[model samples]
Target chain A: MEGRLARIGLRIWVGGVLLFLFVPIAIICFYAFNSSNIQSWPIQGLSVKWFSVAWHDPQVRAAFVLSLKAGVFATAIALLLGSAAAFGVHRFRFFGREAVSLLLVLPLALPGIITGIALNSAFSFAGIGLSLLTIVIGHATFCIVVVYNNVIARLRRVSGSVYEASADLGAHGFFTFRTVTLPMLSTALISGALLAFALSFDEVIVTTFTAGAQNTLPLWIFGAIRLGQQLPEVNVVVVAVLLLTVIPVIIAVRLTGGGGITRGSAAARSAMDSGSPGA
Target chain B: MTSTVAQGGRPGGEPASSRHAGGVPGGGSARLAAALWRRAWLRATLTLTPPLAWFLVIYLASLVVMLVTAFWSVNPFTNTLVHTWTLSNFRQLFTSTYLIIIGRTVGMAALVTVTDAVLAFPFAYYMARLASNRGRQLLFTAVLLPLWASYIARVYAWIVILQKGGTLSWSFQKLGLGAVNIGYTNTAMWLVFSYIWLPFMIVPVYAALERIPDSLLEASGDLGAHNWRTLRSVLLPLALPGVVAGSIFTFSLTLGDFITPLLVGGANSNFIGNVIYSNLGTAGNLPFAAALAVVPIVIMVFYLLGARLLGAFESL
Candidate 1:
């Protein structure tokens, strides 16, 4: 009877915690349709007007485009460098291999402020002007870790015997890699890339340092809120970004063979492992 | 096989293993590729160079530059960095009010971590052991959905909820409680941090708890151990590593966060991150900010080491 009561209490507690987590998100989604610009207790009225207003805003559009550009470039670079490093580390044993893994994981382990200020000062020191390029570079540093983790984890699951078998059948290294490894790694790569893009898209802390004058979507939202204007419009953009990212996240889940949140956690773990797990 | 290959012919009257020497078109390049691939050390070096170069040149070098820059003072007139090494930055940090900021950040991080651990335990336990498979999937998606949502937006939602006469205060009034004037206070920041990082704590703890075999619990109970005793002996000890693993994320993330405080915190709520950010962005004081950055880095280093000692690295 005591165990049963304890279980019931736990169930209620779990429900309350879940409500706490979702209430904010539900509020954001709901108020996106609020007609009033001034947010207050009990939204004034509901309408789709702010969505149009946000759509017409050039600043929002530009910020969205900039975020996309940065996310794409960062994901591309991370995929290349991260997968290469994963293959190198997985296929070869050499001196300092453990050290290399540790090195790759450090950017994830350190605080974002540390990485942000370091990158910020480095750019200023080198006379390198901060631009989208710099933002991509800052993002790719951690993004590579995401890609590396997913790819390496996947690589670990595959056997080395296949590569040797392909070689024995008169296949060149490149051919074997293209035919055997690439096919096997396709899902991992896709999911990893999507997750990488998602991370870069929402990133703000590091972008605050590396971004000179430009605004990514999150930075734009930050600015809009700081200025305390167009609050409804900001809500619309938040809802839109949430939806945009949610689709890719869902797709990544399907690709990874879902078994709970941990199925898609390879990317989440990678994001956390690189240390700046927060936006 | 060696004799036949050395004779340069096989049973079918074909040359054996001549592909590396010169057999097909572009044989030279193929031979070179085969020879290069055969050398493990050379292949490993070639493979390792690009990514290692990127980490060293871009990541490690920047960190080193920032650390070295922390030792150099800035020119007062032009705001340029001076090459002269000085301990004045460290001295200023130790002597000034920055120590309070450090203490507050660490304290808040600890509070947030502990809150998350407590709040996440029953939920994680339910998800790990009690929920049906379908319920588990729904709960998992429910947990992850917020994570994919924009972090700032979620914080903003809290702003909506915690504002004066907002949802929280209004709800409290309806419940016969007084107003919750938590808006723009450290209390607000704590709530938001705990909310945002709760999933991080839950996932790891759930993972750890799920791996605990039911037989162990059954064995303990069969030995006349009460349910509470079984939990204390079988569950708590096993989940401790996950708790530690999750704490590293919560503690470090809260330690490094500047935006949450800027959004929800009051004037007196300056964290170490806020100071470091201001010093870097507006104050143009690289050395001081770099010195401040060292605080969290040092704290995290020790925290990670402690977690490692607790065998939390596997869960991470």
Candidate 2:
């Protein structure tokens, strides 16, 4: 019953929204090549001079390396802990199971500042110093939920009969687990690890409190932005980060067989559904 | 078939019932596996302990410690936490300065939530119902990509566009509107907050709308209802849980954010997060910061309860 004019109007509106969403990102990328230090509209000359500056900057290199280390460590921890928790909740019915699910989600559901300050207080109380270990702990706390959600959703979809058949075939539990369960969970784990790494890589809020004097990539960018002097360097670093982030996400989408990020699982839906509380 | 069956039985070398009774004749690791396989509690405990211990000890304990610290006051002279329980930190939150900060934060969060819901609905509708299969996939990726992009970079992009002598001013000047600088203003913060969180609103709404079958819309059209009537009666109600689910993100993200205010806010734009952050860091007032942090936590607990009541969890 819709009219032609209305349909066309809707299409135009959608196109406009897309533009609104993307133009700022385009502006950031475009400004990175600006030859002049000043960031006014319209181009002066375009140059790649900032690339060398950002490359040579000791602070930026340290931050990038630190971010990489934290992301790798955090993703490793989340994969182990998250899958364990997922199998716990999925394979067996136990008391407090719902509470466990809710608890697993709490780090993600609550605002990041809450998580940040809470961990900060606890660290100081326990006489623990803020370091790379602390940053990984903060990131892994949230990353666990992402991995948990993916694994549990996949676990739910896998048929219980397959395990039973393996058992009946005189294949012991460990052997069946190594062959059957691991293969079934391979994609889910890969996608989960990729996403977890991405999240830990770009994370800023919880990292801010937990990093102490250390700078992750986002923290370095924040300092630079606040200083307002290193516009070009910030732009270069940001472009690199965009690439760093987009690759994993693209890989994750492909690995999940192209349901896109939000459609991966019900738990993922709830996780994203909860939104990034700190962002 | 007979040979294959005999070969399989030969490996076991005993009746299955006898194997069950004696726990499968095997080496230590295999025996341990057999024992674990039989015991449900052991399996649950083995799988559950590490993650649960991590959460309970690290995550949950930290929250409890923060909450307890909120009651204890910090000694100003020594810059040490006084273990004596007191409500003075919480009492300070009721002061006029703190109250305004709380009001502004909640108000802005509400405004952003409304703005995002309005902006997202039409776009999500187009994606869900109108786009072709390939088009829908592209739109989904477009929405998902920015989420993974650095949050700081996105906010920084806005700074470049909003600052004096920036892209926005250049555009305005070119249009004969004279130079316009809205940079470092609350207005800038509002725009950035709404912009960043818009995808959070769209994805869930699109998911909810996609779940609605096409036959229902056709049925509504056949019942003598017009386009607006079908949208209002058939579509809006069905899509509302999604909207509420999205609002939870938009609202809580705004409520807890300090970065936007720090980057783009003017002199008067001290959000609760900003205040708490400063207190915990520069001010060295941990107790006060913990007390202030409680406000958003309480707000979200209620907000989440409201969302749960609206069936937003189901949509998610």
Candidate 3:
């Protein structure tokens, strides 16, 4: 039928579109190991020396440590503030709570350049030199939204009755939260943490404003890409970051099974079920 | 992080033992337990504290500074800023050269938005409504994959392609078209900007389109409405928030972004981002740069508000 023919054509078009999205990237990643220094054809022999050289590059090494430290601290901050903020806003229906929740998420909607300028100006005025601390602070602002979204959604899913039951059972405020609520929200927290880490590590716009003297991986890579560094070494660094990011992404994906599934069992059930690592 | 997650400290079960151990310190075990409890709460607060303070101190305070600086006059000879306020920064921004820059930024952003939207509709529709789940996942990942790659590296990738006899040129040649000479032209800059930002548009559009209820489309089709009209009236309206969200994200990001233009547009063209970058770098005019930044933020806030208003209309 004509319908079937149309469907087949659609599939090919979709596949082509997807290919366009990823092929150049795949080619670049593949050529990372290609022996040629210039980005060109006639694929030559392969070697791991480029990666080692990239690893040994001092700027890359220092940026790697700085980004790692920033990512960890930022993600940790996002997780705690995000969870507490979520619990507070979600559990208690207070005046302006919805507005506050919206305020928490609005930073994400604003462009990174806007937030960058805001942070940069404030830091400069306060005699606050751009250092590791400033970089972490800049990253944590927008990164809050990631964990906040995850925790808020998870908290919303946990019915008020669940908490009410714990209170009715003569459990203290701390005990009820620790024993009952904590287990349920753990997966959302973990998934959010992974995502926040990835965002913090790769963030450059805000980093540009906040990093007065230090270079994160992206900042170093940004200078090298335009100014011309060892292209192979840059490619090698790109590959390493991709693996580091993608693995956590896959785990986050696995941890985040369904976006919404409060049909039967509690959300806690889904967290426990992902104990078997699919990837 | 995975390795750091401690295991087998206390199981979810064992309520009786948990109660006995709680708040009843007897000996070393009690001391150890108290330390663990104290550390948990302390760690939680410590993790959240510094960043929370930073947002209040830096982000909240900076807006106040921006407002103050907008009012204050700059002393060029003295090399200091005075609190004696004036509106010259705002006044000067309205002149022809600066207005031209704002006009160019908005014009390019509009062109990019329309073209990207047209391309993204078919692409996102396929991914959301037509592709197999496995295929969809692959497609979605492909859309997000570019974001992880260094932004500068991707801009550099275009430098290779946009030149004559490059991959794009080769494709044009094969199509019996003359070699495309887009270098240093607005066309090349637009194309490069489009390529860099298309993924941003597709993801949100896909997210929005996937949320369209299948029954609404099916019902429209059954009632003798065709695919295009069904899409126009049913699917499109439902996906308005996503489109708005995506558009707001793309336009605002592209408007503020100077990287692509700096790399590809050459010295002739500059975006607000480059203006800000230059101010902090070679220009050594931080106040003016800071003042210029307020222009786009104010424009974008209005732009987003307009989109949100349109979103409200779509809901009706």
Predicted structure with the largest TM-score when compared to the true one: 2
- Residue-wise lDDT of candidate 1 within A203-270, one digit each (tens)? 88889989988899999998888788878899999888877767766786667543212322332343
Candidate 2's iRMSD: 4.3
What lDDT does each candidate get?
Answer: 0.79, 0.82, 0.66
**Candidate 3 segments exceeding 4 Å error:** A42-45, A258-279, B1-55, B133-138, B147-150, B163-178, B181-185, B281-283, B312-316
Instruction: Kindly report which residue pairs in candidate 3 clash with one another.
Output: none
Q: Model 1, B73-128: lDDT tens per residue?
A: 88988888888899888888786598888899999999999999999878878876
Shift in Å, residue A38, candidate 3: 2.1
Q: Cα miss at B257, model 2 (Å)?
A: 0.9
- Count of steric clashes across candidates, in order: 2, 0, 0
C-alpha lDDT (0 to 100) for residue B116 of candidate 1? 95
User: In model 3, how well does chain A match by TM-score?
Assistant: 0.87
Tally clashes: model 1.
2
The residue-level lDDT of candidate 3 at B142 comes to 61
State every prediction's TM-score relative to the real structure.
0.90, 0.92, 0.82
User: Residue B21 of candidate 1: its Cα lDDT?
Assistant: 39
lDDT of 3 by residue, B1-316 (tens): 1122232233333354456555553644543444444344333333333434445565667767766666665577775666677778778889998898888888888888877777777787877777776777666556555644445556656665665545667677788997677866778888877776776676556666776677878789889887778878888887776666667656877788866766688657977777777766323566677788888878887986797687722321
| CAPRI classification of candidate 1 | acceptable
Q: Whose TM-score is higher: candidate 1's or candidate 2's?
A: 2
- Model 2 docking category: acceptable
Q: Tens digit of lDDT per residue, candidate 2, span B129-202?
A: 88886777778778878766777878888998998888989999989998687888888989999998888888
lDDT: worst 10-residue window of model 1 chain B: B8-17
